[model samples]
Target: MRHIIAVLLENEAGALSRVAGLFSARGYNIESLTVAPTDDPTLSRMTLVTTGNDEIVEQIKKQLNKLIDTVKLLDLSEGPHIEREMMMVKVRAEREDREELKRLTDIFRAKIIDVTDTSYVIELTGASRKLDAFIDTLPGGAIIEVVRSGPTGIARGEKGLVL
Candidate 1:
């Protein structure tokens, strides 16, 4: 089964490398990863998506907690949370196709953040599946490049993950 793990760690140099190395050393693959500094500059939050069974997930969590730099680990897949991903897509578009592209973008709640004579750069944030569907709706051979900030999740209610 696929699992999403959120880790809060000290924002120290080499901390990310250590976490990544731990997974690689164990032959576990990370499907998606996003990290950023939290309100506290001394700490960073990371959300990682991986595929593993219950036992493996628990083992991974236990091992992560053992890392000195790790502050907390939460299994978001089993919790009440709000998950989102951001993506930017550059697609080739002509004047004639611009209107249609704009319409589709509106339907997906995406915005045209940049535009050139031959391309339109769109910014969107939503669930992973929603972004995938938006990308699929574009014309064939129109996409130039795409960038994604892997999914990030947080517990929905007042009860946050315990340290």
Candidate 2:
């Protein structure tokens, strides 16, 4: 029931607020949202994750398209696409734990981006489940802090989503 909806809209002040307000006013939920200016500086691209059955999702899409700022909209979840999220985890890496953590990082193909005598920051990028699996491999109390850039996605093949 989860959906990833990609939208291109005018990159102006209050644009994001309007989109978020629409969801709130309608009592809908956005699990994750990532927005940034696109190649065309006059526009911005937003990727939002939400959940609902087909009917609810269709209704949400129609409402989004009604917005004046919206240039184009696509439900990437409807077709072939790829999704990824990036996660950085700082863990207790001291003494014996250092070797174990290193081994686990290698197994996950994650990079040890930052390191100190007693801690390490490991960066991993992949599907949300892959990140969860990596976190599960760490020993209890080993985690210091975690940061994630929620999933972003795009459709596969030749065509691009555009107006």
Once fitted onto the true fold, the runs of candidate 2 whose alpha carbons sit more than 4 angstroms away are none
lDDT to native, each model: 0.91, 0.93
Assess candidate 1 and give its TM-score to the true structure. 0.96
Q: Per-residue lDDT of 1-163 in model 2, one digit per residue for the tens? A: 9999999999999999999999999988899888989888999999999999898999899999999999999999999998888999999999999999999999999999999999999999998889999999899999999999988888999999865
lDDT of 1 by residue, 1-163 (tens): 9888999999999999999999999988789988889988988999999988888888888988999999998999897788899999999889888889999999999999998898899999998989999989998988999999999998888987545
Q: After superposition, how far is residue 104 of candidate 1 from its true place, in Å?
A: 0.7
The C-alpha stretches of model 1 lying farther than 4 A from their native spots are none
Provide the global lDDT of candidate 2 against the true structure: 0.93
Q: lDDT for model 1, on a 0 to 1 scale?
A: 0.91
Worst 10 residues of 2 by lDDT: 154-163
